[model samples]
Target: MFDFVPTRSDGDALREYAELFRASFPDAGHLNETYLKWLYSENPSGKVVGFDAYAEGRLAAHYVTVPADVFIQGVRQRGLLSLNTATHPDFQGKGLFTELARRTYERGAELGFNFVYGVANANSTPGFIRKLGFQLVRPLDAKISLGHVAKVDWPAVCRTAAFRRQWTEAHLAWRARNPQNAIRFASNRDGVLTAFASTDKPGVVVAGEFSPDGPVTALPCASVPILPRLFIGLLPEASRRRGLAIDVPKALRPSPLNLIYLSLDQKQKTLPADQIALSFLDFDAY
Candidate 1:
């Protein structure tokens, strides 16, 4: 029998998790304690929720999800962003991931989390959808822009998307503190857009157009951009009003990312890809 306990957010525990993570993915950069602490401990949305299973006093597997608030029909509701999960090599065929996820969602529902969502890669998409009963919303589009993004209507986009991420100053700030990617921002007369230097291509800057404050009004942008290079994110239909972005070749991407969702309350929900506003900042993949 496996012993289960709530995942801890302490330094030592995070370090231990990182160790197991490194054992699975050796070249990972986000293995430092600082990154783990910021993600599981310092997130403003809420503390981490998941479980760790032990067998004979050894950690057999670990899984966790972070809390987030999403706007559904203009009302805020609790949500969980399905995140890290790892099991030792010795325990690979035991179906630990499915079991751990099932346990996590049960606790999440008890704590008022309405649903769970995540960006899954090609290899894991099957397990999430077939084994865990997640809905395949859509795949993230890969686009490349040359130092350009036309004026965007954030409020309109938010409303059209039906599922909107509630972005507060605290949550945005917490997102900017990622140790692995030094997320920067450039604010002009229009509004704030998060940016980060991309290592895949030198001199290529990935940017996300987002309104940090409320969407009461629209902001104007200068004809010029400070770090005009390439923009990568969910560019709403409004963004195409006047911009130059071409679809990036699928061959360039390591793997296609698909958005997956599961309703904890067993209520059906629809999240159209064209409507949701998402960026690398919204997920941990970057």
Candidate 2:
């Protein structure tokens, strides 16, 4: 009852993708033409591979896979992330989600992507794990490590799994640089930026994502949130800080989210969940 059209990697197709995103996820603040161009069109690694399903010439469902070169245990692997998936309200519960996903993955395989990964919400996690053979990696957790600040070498850490997002200098430059906020950045001796923290809250420095090798300086004031436990393990034991309760409204919490992946080749199967490191930066922020 619908026609699936593979979208080309061009400006026009990217606009169409953004339009569908706005139509489907109306409440999402980040669904804009600029962000879509930044994500799918201007990505340094490659363009996004996706399809738009139309019912009688009306766009019904949208799906896309953003490819990233994942490094694990000193080896780089071709990986695709299932992203920007949505179905119009008019076409919900018609099996479009599964069909579009299947077709997208099949095309991704032909394009040399050996695996696909997604940080799926509870509602969609089961479909990927039970039906699509995606393994449950782990829940994204917050941790506080007691540690002295160490110099972070950005280039050196790029070969590690902890550097999940392929954020080039251009991408970082385009982000809002509102100096009015309490957000502060830490840089190494070479002047390369390593970590950032939001000092907005009265007594806590809300640490944002950073390079895995970066030092997480514990403030005398106490507490940081949204940091992954895996990165906390990298700190030297002597300087580690105690984990503090990171309280937030239930609606703002993504506790129900889980990381899932499906390996399409033997080489990809070797990359286990324990080695994969991720932060809020790795996933699409909406």
Candidate 3:
């Protein structure tokens, strides 16, 4: 029988975790050890949690949870964001992932989290939906705008006392929390600052307020008809080479967004018939 434990700040334990991740997803490319170290480090004010499963004396599976505050129906709610779940290929079908995930969910609930989120790919979504009984929320709305200048005028925007204070705090917080992720900031000639946060796969431009006092609003550019096409156009050649497919929200399709299909829980009261489909991104595992 294997034992599951929360990974404390042990260097050896973390190295084992990284090795397991690489072995589990050999095609995902390099994930630097330094990056994983920073990710597992704890902050009193931050919202990241790490766990590991051990079989005999070796690490078998690992996962991380990121605490996010999401707005649902104009109310700010706490969300548990699951990421980087992996198990050694040698341990496949041994139920390590399922065991680890259930324990993680219980721990998250104990920590006062209301929802669990994850983005699953084609191989794992069905099991998450069928076996775990996780309800599918609405497909995340993602839009992209191209011809975007890669540069920004940070100095000019920093001139404003309010903008400078908020920008500095947000930037630092983001960096400290997401050491493995890339965050870019820029400003235009009009002194309007824009911030973007992305992983190697998908990118999101931070536009509106995401705080308790702030109201959630989609980006103005998100409404542009060409945004979807622009996003599809921007996929990295490497991702396309590997057969990465973009999953678009159903409501956004056919109008300007050109989304393909959407995933929703059939048991959910609000789901529309014929509009629901299997999600490429699993909400429970994100």
Candidate 4:
């Protein structure tokens, strides 16, 4: 049997979260105390909401939802970004994953959040759909551009898009402090693009490009990818084919990323996949 405790943002809790994270995921070493503090505690939107399972006083499994404000149907609403989930090897077959999510979502709804969403990889898609009642919206497009990638009119795109993550200056500042790597931001007379070193490969991932203040910030970059790598977000539904970018085939990608959503209010319909615009910056892609 396991006891599920609500996750908290405190000195002891932060340490435990980081400890559990490193124990649960092989590549979670970078998510130490400092990183967890910034992620789970310092979000400008809201605090992290989730549960930690303890078995005989040992932290065995955990799941957390990062709070975010998103535009659903062009209307801004409070939402939860379904993120970090981990279970120690010994705790695997006890239904902790779904139960943790269930309780977390329950708590999220209690906190008055409108929806919960995330980018789910191929392996986790079925579990989310068949088990967790989430809709597998669409497979995110992956494109690689050795040079400049074309920019779309974001205001125009937002008008047609079914969903978009709300980005404020505060949110942008919090994201830039990520301990994982440095995000290089480039601006242009048209828009702004942010790229960071990809942990998976030897290049940078274009986080996302934005048209903010209702206008362009600085001059456009000579080339998009400063390191000449890839951009793993929406390329077709939201962007166009220009510059040196080519769509990466499914077979070539190490793993396929799919956007998934579950509305806290059952009355709200699942947002359409086709109109959703995403990028690494939108979620925990780093």
- Give all candidates' CA lDDT scores: 0.75, 0.59, 0.45, 0.76
Per-residue C-alpha lDDT of model 2 across residues 1-286, encoded as one tens digit per residue:
8998775656776667667777788876466666666667666567887787899988888888887766545566677878888888889989887888888888888888877878887888889877777888765554433222333333545554522544444334322222223223444445344334443234434343344323334312223344421221132222223344332444655456677777776565533544454544455422
Return the TM-score for each candidate structure. Answer: 0.89, 0.71, 0.58, 0.89
Give a tens-digit lDDT track for model 1, residues 144-173. Answer: 766555557765766565566777767766
Report the error of model 2 at residue 80, Å. Answer: 1.4
Cα deviation at 19, candidate 4, in Å, is 2.1
Best by lDDT: 4
Top-down TM-score ranking: 4, 1, 2, 3
The TM-score that candidate 1 achieves is 0.89
lDDT of 3 by residue, 1-286 (tens): 7888975546786677678877988775445467665555543224466577888988888877765543332234455556668888878788877777777777776776655555554466666667655544333334333433223223322221110112234323444344544433344444343334432334333221111122213222223122212122111111112222244554644433111111122221222222221111112111
lDDT of prediction 1: 0.75
Clashing pairs in 3: 82-286, 117-286, 118-285, 118-286, 119-286, 120-282, 152-186, 152-187, 153-187
Better of 1 and 4 by lDDT: 4
Enumerate residue pairs that collide in model 1: none
Give the clash total for candidate 1.
Answer: 0
Count clashing residue pairs in model 2. Answer: 6
